[model samples]
Target: MQATFLIYSFLYLIVLIFLLPFEYFKRPASLRKRWIREKFGFFKKNEQIETFKPKIWIHAVSVGEVVAVSRLIKELSSKCEIILSTITDTGQKIANDRFKNYNVKVIYIPFDIPFAINKALKHFKPLAVILTETELWPNLIRIASKKMPVILVNGRMSDKSFNGYSKIKFFMKPLLKRLTLLCVQEEQYKERFFNLGAEEQKIHITGNMKFDIELREIHFPWENAIAQPVILAGSTHEPEEEIILDAFLKLNITGSLIIAPRHPERFQAVETLIKRKISESSREISFSKLTEMPSAFSFKSSTSVVLVDQMGILGSLYRICDIAIIGGSFIAHGGQNPLEPAYWRKPIICGPFMYNFPFIEEFLNHEACIMIDKASLLEILKELAENSELRQTIGNRAYQLFLNKSGATEKTLRLIEKVIP
Candidate 1:
């Protein structure tokens, strides 16, 4: 078993080295330096650590996972020092900026190699390591398990991932065995992991921690800045923006619309798309990016749509908007978080492809959110706009579900304390 593992590790290392130049050069200049630093595990934050001291290590790969685990980290911060690591630049930025208020040491996690993992483990001698959602690193799990319990929190195994792992089930057994426990989102996900060589006894269904998110009341400047109710289409992908524009045009009500694309790189692309849509229409309308003005800023009489090109303000926008059209759902990208809008008592319109968000089913069934064909988006928007009471009914149902599902984070905390406390 050890021999086979070593062979696989060596091959993985070869692939990593082969792709180094391609990956390194592709990053923008601002992030290239950080990439270089992470490659050597030379993060400035770990410089002060000279010896083995007990801390908690939480690894989240990107913005979505990072946001999902925000409340978990907050509750755990008071109990122990935390070393948070993220793979993407945007996730790293949020980790550093948001977690600075707590006992968190944010750093970019190095690639999954023995040397890099060893360096990170040496600096922060954690009592336990918590990996968030589908972050199954073979070497890191195996090595860390030998020192302390390594738990997979809010674990999920999609059908696509399960099929991939089942093909390599023989080699995956050793890796799965190393994990102390699997706290999964649902029973189906736990069963999927078990079928993929995970020990049935080691997996527990803890539900999704994202449902237990702490919703903060943020006063958005745009909320008071505009004269009419705002419709926000947040975390949108490619053609989703165009769909939103077409639907808003169908709405008989007069209100400002904000479209925030999911990827930072697509901000310019969405802006261009929106401008073209505005110009093609016969009616005169105004447009601007959210970064252009403050809360006190007023829109021109003809101003209608605004593009939120900036990051870290989506939550605030959710608090202010009357209706939310979550991005990624309208396309094949699964779905973005519906809980964000639900927390603010706002009705949501999601696309049919919501496989990524298994939890949204309850909201849909309870009439907290509505899912329609992209073609029917116009009809739904028009109906909701005409009947204020129908919109309120959807929002109320979703908010009630959000309240009922508020205990996942607390449940996860108990499991963590059981292992590490």
Candidate 2:
């Protein structure tokens, strides 16, 4: 092994060993054994790939990445068998659910330790490995690149990520060089990759695959169950829920509030917080869970607040909502996707910290959505709730922008075709 690879591998194993206990215990009891087994590169006999056609291994870190690359995976499935690996349990579940029909095998990504990575690579023997966004696992790239093409699709580099990577340029440069191609989301990401020691010729601006989101005509029973105008706070995090709940309570007009937190593990915590906050308040807002929708649940005459304890339904829920308050922005968590609501032609609201998504600037320039501070959230919510005309105008603009920004998936697929072994 190269000296840099040796050093990184050693350090990575040491860290993994130290954190194994915490990582193992933090998972739910149901997933503990499977998580540990998959992390160490063990797979069932049926999970093994034995395709006559070429096999492609694609790694997406979480739900966002998995969703971003879903279309590409579908396109590739017709050409090659796919081994789709993800790090988070949610990502694994969604990937499995999304590609169950396609020629794709969804599994947890092996621990970055050399032994696990080698075991995985030897077993799958993929023709090419594609990583979504900024997943630059050193051992995985270094080892896999020597055997097969390792490409990065829909790549991006945030300011924080660039600064941290720059500090370790000596270590990162070699890994970046080893990547057969880097298909970035924008010109800024291409420039960042160039600065971080990736050859300029190797980086291509293929646009963001997330832009080419395939919005389905999904109909859930909640579509007709709720009578009040719904304020869906999609993908909310810790303190953002508090802010959203407070803002919803202050709205003059009556409306239901839906809080869909980013992580499923935090569902109970957010539900408890919502119940406590509603109990402490003066208004009569009924609380309920989304799983009871369409049958067991009924919206109270007064304002109703619902906690989304389910997954894979937020995008569909966007169609039923009046206004969408994006989460993760208010507290510098770098905002979730705003395009889902934009696709449904719903007025969107987010905070000022959307650096993770550089394309959000275009929305701001066009005044397609409302980006405000935490203190201004209630004020903005009140205005949107009261003004139907204003909501329609903003929602229309956002849908137009979304329509204009598609075709990224086609662009990325053409580039991948060139590198496929």
Candidate 3:
């Protein structure tokens, strides 16, 4: 164990040192110092807690994982003192805003080095560690597990990840065995974990926590500002936007179109692409940013294309739109979550590549959602736009499926209660 750790530490330090300059320069000027300090296990505030409850450390890697466990954190907050750590700056921002009222201390995760991990563990002094999804930091897991439980909640293994991890099963087995318990999303994930050296007895299929998300009732100005028959191309990637925009133009719909790119860094580039495309077209399509419009502004007779530049509002956009187009699937990128739109009973459509979301297969089997190719996108959109009854039928089916899969959170919490103490 010592030898493996030594080799791992050597390789890890080398890579970290190599990437330090690139990572430092990539961050905004104001956040560079804070990001560097936090990653090295230095925190600004040190306070004492008066509560007698056991302290738990929860780590989520990024936005998706953070949002998946939002409600779980809320429920756990009242039960214990919580130290929530996230890797990405965006995830940290969302967690802070989402859990501002709760007793959660949001911070950046420490680098996976012995000294850094030791500092974090000593400072937090948590009784147990709850990790979201597939965050398998070797040093953190190995060290923390020696003292307390290191549990994985809402765990899943995609085909891509499974193939990659399978190649290094020798290295993964020790880390997987160190985990006291694994609460996975599905039966397949349990099988995958077992194959990767997690003890079968220690792994449990607890369903996905995302199904139990407590959606906020958002009231945004876009709700009233946008025109009717609105089509939302949500969580879109590169070429998908171009395809959607071209399809909308060909369909010549007289309603609003909202394109929400997946990454915040791409907002300006997407806006430029939209403007260039609109300028070249002969049609009188107007384009604007969602942030710039007044609360009560109305679109003219021609078609309107609005770019969503903000973060954490995709759920609200899904609620107001008439038809939803799931992005990322159009390209090789796996699809985004469809549950948000399903929660609002919105008719959903996506491309063929949805391997990231294995549960989507069930939706397709039940006829709950529509899956189309790039060539057929225009036809499907036009059909759904014209046929209100078809849209309602599909939306109702998706909503029913969503309700049927709602108890994962309660099951996971019950399992956590058994081991947390």
- Per-prediction TM-score, please? 0.94, 0.97, 0.97
lDDT of 1 at 1: 79
Regions of model 3 farther than 4 Å from truth: 45-52
- Model 1 Cα shift for residue 255 (angstroms): 1.5
Q: RMSD (Cα, Å) of candidate 2?
A: 1.4
Model 1's C-alpha root-mean-square deviation from the true structure amounts to: 2.0
RMSD of each: 2.0, 1.4, 1.5
> lDDT per residue, candidate 2, 1-421, as tens digits?
3887788778888898899999999888998998898899888777787769889999999999999999999999999999999988899888888888999998889999788888888888789999989999998998898888999999999999999999999888888999999999999999999998898898998888887777667777555667567899999989899988887887756778989999998999998999999888887778888887765456775688889999877887898899999899998889999989999999999999888888888998898999999999989988888888999999999999998988888988888888884
Candidate 2 to truth, TM = 0.97
Better of 1 and 3 by lDDT: 3
Clashes of 2: 0
For candidate 2, the lDDT comes to: 0.88
